[model samples]
Target: MDINNALKADPAPLGLAGFGLTTFLLSFVNAGILSGSAVNVVMPLAFAYGGFAQLLTGAFEMRRGNTFGFTAFTSYGSFWFFYAFLVIFNDLKIISIPGKALGIALILWGLFTLYMWSGTFRLNLALFLTFLFLWLAFIVLGFGSYYSIIELTRLGGIFGFLTAFFAVYTSFGIVNNSLKPGTIPLGPAILK
Candidate 1:
């Protein structure tokens, strides 16, 4: 079966929703709105929805020939998987990851996001804002963890909340538009 012809639905909404919800939950803990123990609930959700579901969405995007969606969904999905495993391993005492190392990893992710944000110019305002906030969140979180600064971490959490909001709004707009075209305005692309 030819996937390009067989797959018709847009998968971005699923990917965005998964990422947004997971980020929102984790950000709650990071922002100090919830206890760290809340991660016990978030871990499984990250593994199941954020990781697995986004991977599925990425595959669909590939079938649709959307390179940006494929990359974004797959990479972030892998990130969720990495996060879930990191927590699991730490809990099991299988391997210990230093805060500095985690911070460096996050900074690297931020670098990746920064480049990805450049691509959003050709997309829409929703994606532009989402990537912008996401990049900021990662950088702040990376610095916070690296320097053991609680305030930076909290600021990152605030950025994470903003990222999640835009992502969720984009997802909702996409889905709504699918059902009723022009029901939600995604705004014009910054680039022609």
Candidate 2:
């Protein structure tokens, strides 16, 4: 049988799954947000969070022809790799520049995701919209922190959590849709 035939309608390949899964894992290692600045502190946190898991996920997502999977998994996976090698890049000794930079990047990416969110309804729609607006809102919050709006960063973290929650919840759709054999409403990910 063709490999494609075995899947349940373009469900994320293991790689894509791994990418999102690994990203989810990293959030735990970092201490009290980006409030601290120490290689000893940050590097270990990154190493624990960043590893081959993301690479595996990205490579598989690429094989599955998931542009979002490819882009997200690969980019974030690389971020961890680079994050680990701060020895050369020196990601520390800075005042949370990465957060502000991440905000900028996320804002740009959110614009694209918003476009994706506009696609015809499908099993993936909810996941995508949840991901899009949450990140867009998250970016705004992150940037706000740079301007001393600490509440913004807190709010950003909430959106970020929303992003994570949906990512995890969306995984359930794979199981639910597969079980239902053909029915799962579309666009709920944004709301639920």
List ranges where model 1 is wrong by over 4 Å: 1-6
Residue 68 lDDT in model 2?
67
Candidate 2's TM-score reads 0.58
Q: Which residue pairs in model 2 clash with each other?
A: 15-57, 126-189
Clashes in predicted model 1: 0
Candidate 1 lDDT, 104-154, residue by residue in tens? 999999999999999999999999999999999999999999999999999
- The C-alpha local distance difference test score for the whole of candidate 2 amounts to 0.52
Q: Local distance difference test, per candidate?
A: 0.95, 0.52
Where is model 2 poorest over a 10-residue stretch in terms of lDDT? Answer: 23-32
